[model samples]
Target: MENNNFLLKINNLKTYFYLDEGILKAVDGVSFKIEKEKVLGLVGESGCGKSVTAQSILRIVPPPGKVEGKILLHQKNGSAKKEPLDLAKLDPQGKKIRSIRGKEIAMIFQEPMTSFSPLHTIGNQIMEAILLHQNVNKQEARVLAIDMLDKVGMSNPHRRIDEYPHQLSGGMRQRGMIAMALSCNPSILIADEPTTALDVTVQAQILELMKDLQAKFGMSIIYITHNLGVIAEMSEEVAVMYLGRIVEYASVDDIFDSPLHPYTKALLKSIPKVGKKAKVRLDSIKGTVPLPLDLPPGCSFYARCGQAKEGICNKDTPPLLEAKEKHWVRCFLYT
Candidate 1:
């Protein structure tokens, strides 16, 4: 039985892609929970399974991808009892999962340009999402869609509504995507690098807008990003992933102030701080991420981890263990 405190719980999730070469474990044995109305940041470098984990939750992984384990969602049935639904067990194209997807859990993809259809007007797309889960008519859907656009800080929403994706600026397009994702009043929102392609100003604007919306709607969010600064600003909790696994999980304060895993420490050091002396070279973690098919036998991060032990890190995998209250780290150093 799952704890009633959590809105969504992922248990031992393993999403693998079967290519001709070999099986790619994109998300291997990942587990976590999102509390009601809280934001959880999933942070890592490229190819670290941050986006793949988010996609697995939505059942949107492309072909040859096999998703295993439980994704339990605490769903309210318009009654006092809230039943737990295992999203991984449901058919990907079935009505039950489809209905639950956009209605209960919505996702704003990394890039808005690729996500939106060029042929359709922004209003039409937003209205489509509203129509899919909402019982309102076309006119009502349009009204709600425009309202959402306005809420997301899009100016002249009435005029912008008729514009196509090509007509809007990158920031506006991203805000439009957020409007569509939240139109259904989803309980959980998976924002996968929502600010990746925007300018610094626009990125700040988008983050503030998301914070305001989260406060207003009281919806939980899973924020995926490589930027630790953004993670610190937006998320209450953080999970550091590497090679398809979460190496560290803790509150944002704990992650920044007291990172336990070697990978997490390396990532923090890579960031340039404001007080650093002039002309000083920024620190970087050495070694490239291992390819999915070429992962090591024991700890996948052993090759790249700076504090790896000779026998333990390379010979046996370390389980995720709690180092402090509510802080978890997967490293032999803690064990």
Candidate 2:
């Protein structure tokens, strides 16, 4: 059931990839929702299906992989009261999804160097995006692209529009990517590790820019990142993932102040506090994530969880149960 208050609601989404070795369950039974104009931070370690989840939402899973389950998007707030569309059932290459992808839902990928085409100028790429979704002439699209560039803090927007991806610095390239993603004025933005390769200062600047843009556009955002600091700074709500499932979901303050899952606790403990003693070693979660091809039948975190019990955690996979008001944790400890 799609809630009218939610702009996007994902119900038990399972994206799996079939390979010569075996089936890789990249995203298994994940469900969440993004309210209108709210930022939801998806935090997890590498290979935790965060990126795959985002790609599945946009129907961009590559060949050999298939996405299952409901991804209901509520098309409210526009001129017409359009019916709720199930993105999971839509054809990936069909015109309907294509029109919805850029115009309604946009994404900022991790690496800008690879995201931009080396052959085309920045202006051409952005203008093409605008022309694809909106009914605009080339000249009008060029002007809009330049305006977007200027809004994203690009210096000499007219000159920068003609520049190639390699011509700009790392920060500038990221800003250009943001500009392109926002050019279509999407209703929802998926940011997947947008500050991965930037320096600390530039990372702050980019984060600030995203906040400013979100306020200006009043768009809902799904911010995917491993950095707890970034999550604390950018998100109003937080969902912590392990393996391919969400282990904990709660408000940002509750996540940091009263996390229920062991995995979430370990992640928070790993972050170094600003005024803490310098000589103290940072805490780390023991054991690595199990291989996706051979996932255990019980709790996926059983091998790594220090609080795992013999008969409970090792024998049964706990469902995500509500422990507090709007706080859900997938663990027997909470149940």
Candidate 3:
């Protein structure tokens, strides 16, 4: 997406985890911008650092995991100059980052059960988020929480507000998590595989709910998922990541119709399509993701890239080159 109206600008972000063997570059030099009220799809296989990039924006990486590079937040004031708060430079316990967590930037995790407090009632958790972010009384927070629950399409929201997480259905709990995330009307929302654990029908329902809420709230979204189908439904612009770097980025239609990068093409071909001659075979990418600690010297996908050239692909890292207007890919073939 265009960076002119950017809400969150992440430049060359590197989040490294210090391990016994060496530093594991979970997110290495990842860069992307999310514009105001736009959806940016981050599609990749498992361990491709999509989730790590989202977490880095919020500065939520656990201990021994260090993050670097500029994370600029564009304020609502319509100024080109970014807020002085560099997310990477913020102290872990500082008030600036803490103040922005639930209010300015919120995240919806893959599993709601794991995120929710098992002992606490759903109402209590949602109320806590509201109360912490806004200077509202207990009664006001409860009312706001119930209103949010209703907004997220929960049934009998007032009654369900008092119920524990275990009492709600899988879809309901997912809705509840979305409700909590939106309670403060954050400027940016990072949804990390929000529908992964739900049934197909429920997944559609949750996706619809998220889109509706996005329209209502006008918040930027960073949708991180492995499913290209979900990316097609939710995002306007899509970035295909391999290993720890973005291999291709373009509008959703462009990526799907004319994918430039070999990895992106392979992923699209691997998807099962209807109305096609039923093949006893399905396309699959060979090999597994390389270990983060000992990534290949050059392009991480060189080992499995069918289009890889002998010396060029394995000797030098390819820069992200423009393939078309507003379309970019990292490969020697294009450069």
Best by lDDT: 2
Model 3: lDDT of residue 90: 89
Tens digits of per-residue lDDT for model 2 on 1-335? 23466788899999999999899999999999998899999988778899999999999999899999989898645533566789999999999899898789999988897789999999999999999988989999999999999999999999999999989999999999999999999999999989877777788899999999999999999999876768999999999998889999999999999999988888888764422322213256676776688776789999888899988888888999889988999999878
Off by over 4 Å in 2: 1-3, 76-82, 272-283
In the range 1-335, model 1's lDDT, one tens digit per residue, is 24567889999999999999999999999999998899999988888898889889999889899899999898845432566889999998889989988799999987897879999999999999999998999999999999999999899999999999999999999999999999999999999989877777788889999999999999999999877778898999999998899999999999999999888888787653322321113256667777778576788888877788888899988999988998999989998
Considering summed lDDT, which 10 consecutive residues are worst modelled in model 1?
273-282
Candidate 3 residues 1-335, lDDT tens each? 34456778888899999988899999888888888899999988888888888888888898799999989886555467655356888886789889889899999998999889999999999999999989999999999999999999999998999999999999999999999999998989999989888877788899999998899899989998877777888999999988889999999999999999989888787653321222212247788777688776778889988989988899888999887999999999998
Report the lDDT of model 2 for residue 298: 83
Which is the winner by lDDT between candidate 1 and candidate 2? 2
Clashing pairs in 3: none
What TM-score would every model get versus the actual structure? 0.95, 0.95, 0.94
